[model samples]
Target: MLFKKTATFITAIMLSFAALFTPFPSHAEAHATNSYQSLENTINAILSDASIKSAMTSVTVRKASTGEIVYEANADRKVTPASTLKLLTAAAALETLGEDYRFTTDVLTDGTISNGVLNGNLYLRGQGDPTLMKKELDQFAATLSKLGVKKINGDLVGDDQWFDNIRLSPSIDKSDETYYYAAQISALTLSPNADYDAGTVIVDAKPTKKGYKPKISVTPDEGIVTIVNKANTVAKGKRNTLSIKRQHGTNKIMVSGNIPVGSSKREWVTVSNPTAHTLAIFKSSLSSKGIKFSSTSKNVRRQAPDTAKVLAVHKSMPLKNLMIPFMKLSNNTHAEILAKTMGKKVYGEGSWNAGLRVMHEYATSIGLDASEWHFEDASGMSHKNKVSSAQLTELLLLVRNAPWYGSFVKSLPISGIDNRFVGGTLRNRLASPSVKGKVIAKTGSLNNVKSLAGYAETKSGETLVFTILTQDHKDSTLPSIDKIATAITTTPIY
Candidate 1:
């Protein structure tokens, strides 16, 4: 009887020790485990889709409040991020340039005005404002008109020295040059519309009577680009094979092929030299304002003199407001312009090298390992840009506490929202009842590459940060990606 009592006592001590080492999970921990497991299962099922099987995909999801990773799949594998890289660019810009920053275009004159005539050169100096429109140019002309500038005896000079002379990123594909998204970067540039596609013009080809040439018109036609119309308006129901191309190294745009009688086509065609284009438009605005230039006055590209007088200045909308169109429309030109602006702000040189250095510094400050990734251009137009999903999620988490976080979040595309500024690239995606309005993200695509990254609000009222990067897929994987995001939103995490 004594021996039996001793054995029981020893067993009780052993049980106590075991319990100390392996205590039961707390309520919060238990909930987290179940939530993570559920998310993993849901995401894995979507990733197993046949369409995504051939693609190299990476995914990472984290709890925003705790930075706890909920799920990851090949998260460390580096792949081209496509336009999702804009997320990094956007954050870096907000941090480096601040939300209240504004880009400015200034009108300066080297000569004195007397009796309503400028005695010397009239200068338009651009400081990398991508939002400069014809209306703003008209305003500049009006300001000059108010300043008694009636005629110019010297040259009308364009000063784009704020940035380097390199018009296109070295890593850009040659085929993308004619498109507005690949428009050349210039400190002095112009946009045709409120969408603010700088360095390009809007070409509209409306079909006229059947078998006749379609009426071709260019918006804000400042005579910088010459249009060659070779397209014909075919009978109704005919195939519209119309094509518009701007020849390489020239401002000549060729429009060819047939359009159906009722069909009209519009294209945003990039100009060869944006600085010269701005000069032409400004001259036109000046003419409209009744400001005359002598026949001997030339249009030239030169730096403004230090002693030049500031006649007028046009300030862009704050960086916070600019973020709406920039992130919503995935504006590549805006990304590049911001990058160069950062370089100019920090290193006193507006070159990609300087700008990327600032971006790298900002990334490192946000706990991202800058050495692990490569980005040749601020805009992900270059396929050389590479980033892992894990790194992107890390970035997304750290930026949550930023002062500009609200602006940043507001800039992302909301799923199922039809408004272009609100829905952006995600307008028609993930529109099912369970997922609509739950996912806010950036959508990315390139040849054989796709990505989506941002935040998802779960049913449990938790915000989850996620990044999905896919590359080299033969088929479209956007549907599968959307399903994965939907799963994240609907899965019970609590």
Candidate 2:
């Protein structure tokens, strides 16, 4: 039986790879066996198990220094790449924009400030900084207070020209409004993954005088949503729904629900309406600051006149640290915004559509065959992107040699524990028992789809680049996150 196969087109596509890497030695006895055949057999065993029949798997393992494919299974079957796409984005960014790139947000006053009032318009301009919210914005507002300006004489505007335009993915439907997938990226998304602008209710269940009824405040980000909290804490580990709804263009936030008193302020995990929540927080913050202005916020249509007086300026957290957390934690919003930032740097706009084209072009120039790969969005939130396992492995191999490898490795999580952070990765079990901590890659999961790609250094002094992508719908039984992870960790490639 054909355990692994590749089309002529794929081999021809790989011919281009010759310019990128040299072939590996056939007898690097340091691996699990003397040659690639034994490794191939092991991979076949793993892929052929009856339990794996339902999975749609495509994989490729290559000696990193020599690009020699040790084992492969459906290496050319195109499938969803998920967040692994971040690697390409990260690569393009590292090569074209350099690792020290930073996104900036500037505050400008169309007029001058005097006697606690801005004589002209107040403009909040952004260059698509994803981390501009709450604390950052609060600090910005505070600086204006010190400048002897308690009020704005004109409109409080939002200048987001860094992005050509912003819109939601048409792939999502109306029901997805509250889901993160339906979020609309802005030049000023503020918190990563749309955290703060996603509406937060200060659950004041602290034994109030009103017989313990929770006090919910209306601070919708987009200003038109209602939060219905059906959550009431009963015991430890008890969970309920924190639902939110809204009509377009309204500032009224209605929250009704029961919450268990944790004896502390708790952030219950729940979906949020990002757009409405952002607008709400902005309104609330401005109101509390006594910056008297109408509820109406006009999008700054043109650049704040260069002659515009300078009142205040705000900066986001450093990009270096942000990139690690975004990649290691697999932050969808941050990844999307990062790609958008690339678009802005390259073409002066942050549209995902534009950024995506940029990513593909970069990959092609790096030796990937355009006919063998496809991409839709940088975030991988959409189900439209596709790429083969062999190609993925090849890409990772290139990234391994890139100058930004350290920052790249720091982006993936570790194994065994940790839900969405710290501990969720495949260990270096098979390659080198002591070769742990050397493999750093991204893990992806969407419905029946699963993917793992990264670099591995073996005890035999060999470094390997690998990618395993599985799609199982019928008899698809996942190997408990830990076991599947172990398989990757334990691969004896070192």
Candidate 3:
């Protein structure tokens, strides 16, 4: 159901001394006026545009220092927040796991090494580390090589018991199975690149001689995926339309379409079975080290026997360092991995329900009203998630004073920045001289939902925490949203 709340204005507020640097008239003279009507008018005018006539929007702005409600409209209503929900997840992770936490991937064996002919299963275990790459797994193989005994007489096993078997959320669309952004989660998984996109691979198609089939390759060059090429090379001036997709429930990727003779294209496709993907990569890495195992006959799930010996382990970068790519790029896999890790840490289980419970408990402890929000998954990919603007702003205010605030804020994508590492999704947004570098917020977008929430530093140097969510808007609502953000920064202090 759609809902809206009339704008609320809190008056008789003492002017903040930080207003000295404000671009408006002198602070004292502006204080004499004692009203935020102009700012409200500017924001309202943008919202009243014909493009959002039927859209439901909620906005709330509060003084970061005093928690004063500077302006609010429908702030109490619940709305889908898209990726902006990462703000809450990131904060919860920092608080629950601490900034120094790390994820570890280990290699072990159930049998002893003897005379180069040990006869037992070699198990690869994971702790839901999203950043596991081929290089790290190769290091494990190298360590095994240095251990002196190398012939395995049993099937290679993958142990993913750290988390439940449910790899993908039930609510996620089945059609998205091939998209890397909606990759499956596993305690043991392979990321295609350093971006840490777990459970996915990069498919590269390059044009060959005209009239010949295009050459196809997959990154990390693992034999895990089966590529079926139906693509053709066309004349240099022909259209370069191409389509790459993984068949449902399998790792059979179909590459089709025309590629101009000199062109090349790439697609990041999700792997159907994350465990198998990890095992394959590890096996490949092992063979590269001249270490050969007895059989590729069977790859199954099993626990590392108590007698198993530790071979080698790879520890991920600290959680604080991971926050940059996770938050900056809005990585869904990282979010899910951290959620399960939290569950494992707090409840001895690594399921979403248990992890979300920990996050919920943390939220309540921090003073957010329970009725104001609900978390369906750590990542905001699920549409079932809902949160009120007031809840977001309040949470923002609370975290600003937390011990981990420094790392958390640095993780956020900054505005007006062109570098992907710096600007993230907001790099090109809000670039106006007055707004650029002045606002640091998270951006969320889905079918018809758009949300922006975070802190904005005004010309007066007053820090304001705000959230703006628009639902059911068909037309591009970013400009209007940008206007609202700009309004908050330029709004005179009265």
Candidate 4:
């Protein structure tokens, strides 16, 4: 009996040792391992396609709920991010400026009203309100008229010193200056429409008849730009190859090309000087409102005096509302304006340098190493801007818990949606049934670069944050990129 007991004890000790040395995976661990392998196979197969085979590509995917990275391909390699850099700008803006911040434009006077005549300068001070429209100026003029000021004996001064006098970003190509997307940035500016395309005017060309000059018109008709119509109307079925270009450093828009007899063409041209443009429109509005300027009144650009009293003020929609257009349309002017505004608010200086410093600091506070990336301009218009896919995915993951995350995510362009404001740039792309409405991301394109980065809902109900950055390809790589996103959305994560 004693011998049998000793043998049993030895057997039990051996069994315990065997269990410790060779353990079985729990159900959760097995699922995660299989999921990781499946995701890798799927993404790798998509990346091998001929469309993006020659291009430099970087991809990164992470679980939204937890910070665990599920897949990555050269994710640490830094490359130009194009407009995807807007993701960083959007997050930093929301975190620093808050969702309720509003830009303000004010009309102030240094002189007292006496018998319907003001003896001092009527100052128009702008604090970077890009949504200022012609109607707003008309309203300003009407306010002055209602206040019983029929004439001003002083100059109509424009105070655009709220931001620096730099009109265009240093990284903008010379050829792009005449286009609306590269519109000048100023504290005072005007947008012709509700799209809030500030510092630009709409040039509409309606074909009058064949073999004749097309009828051309500029919106607002404020005389801020000179129209040099050089286009002619062609036969009804002829190719409508109309071209509109603004001269360098001037508002002389040169319209050239052929338009079908019945077809119309429109282009958004950037103005030469935004501050001057705003002043001219305001002057026109004053005249329309029957508020006349005295013979001695001179229209000029000057700062508002310290003694000036506010006569009228217009506050822009909160930053939350502005994000819809800024992110949806990828407005470069708005991004830069917000950058300078952040700088001015945080460091008392409204300059790109100051604003970028603020952004860099915010990035560091959120676990990003500032030294790993470089951004010359907030809008990613600069070719010098470089960042890694991993960095962008990390940013998306970290900001998920922010108080303003809802507003930030809502601003992203949704895939397969038809509404201009709702689907944004991604409306026509990624329309596959399984992927449609499953991806919300930002689309980016520069000369030879294209990128897509945002969130995707997987088949297993897991939210994935992904970034795909591609550059240096001769052909279009968007198809392959979209395929990758589709795979991410359809692949089971569990």
For model 1, how does the per-residue alpha-carbon lDDT over 188-304 read when each residue is reduced to its tens digit? 999989889999999999999987999999988875899999899999998999999898889999999999988889999999999999999999999998999999999999999
Which pairs clash in model 4?
A: none
Return the candidate ranking by TM-score, descending: 1, 4, 3, 2
User: What local distance difference test score does each model get?
Assistant: 0.87, 0.57, 0.81, 0.85
How do the residues 1-494 of candidate 2 rate in per-residue lDDT, one tens digit apiece?
A: 01222475335323323322333333241233345554565567666777776577788777666676676778889878777777777777676667777677766776777787677777667776656656666666677777877766676666666766655544445554444444556664445233332122322222122224454443223233444443344432334233334323342333334444443233312124333344445545666677665345343345567687666666665565566556665656666676777777777767877777778788888777767877767766666778898788777766656676656555555332233343333432222333234445677766677777775544343556778777655544345322333344354543
TM-score of 3: 0.91
Pairs in steric clash, model 1 = none
- How many angstroms is residue 298 displaced in model 1 relative to the true structure, after the best TM-score fit? 0.7
lDDT (tens digit, per residue) of candidate 3 on 1-494: 11222232011011221321122211110111226567777777877888765788889877665677777888888889888888888988999999999988898887778877657788999998888898898888888888875677888899999998878765579988899888999999888887889989999999999888999999878857999999899999899988999999989999988999878999999998899888988889888887788755467887787778888788889999899889888898898888888998999999989888888888898878866778688888877789988889888777876788877877777667666766688988987767766677888888888889988877677777789988877786787888899998887766
Each prediction's TM-score versus the true structure:
0.93, 0.77, 0.91, 0.92
Cα shift from native, residue 188, model 2 (Å): 1.8
- lDDT by residue (95-176, candidate 4, tens digit) is 9999999999999999989998887889999989888899999999999999998888889999998888777778988999
Worst 10 residues of 2 by lDDT: 202-211
| Distance from true location, Cα of 289 in model 4, Å | 0.8
Better of 3 and 4 by lDDT: 4
Regions of model 1 farther than 4 Å from truth: 1-32
Give the candidate number with the greatest lDDT.
1
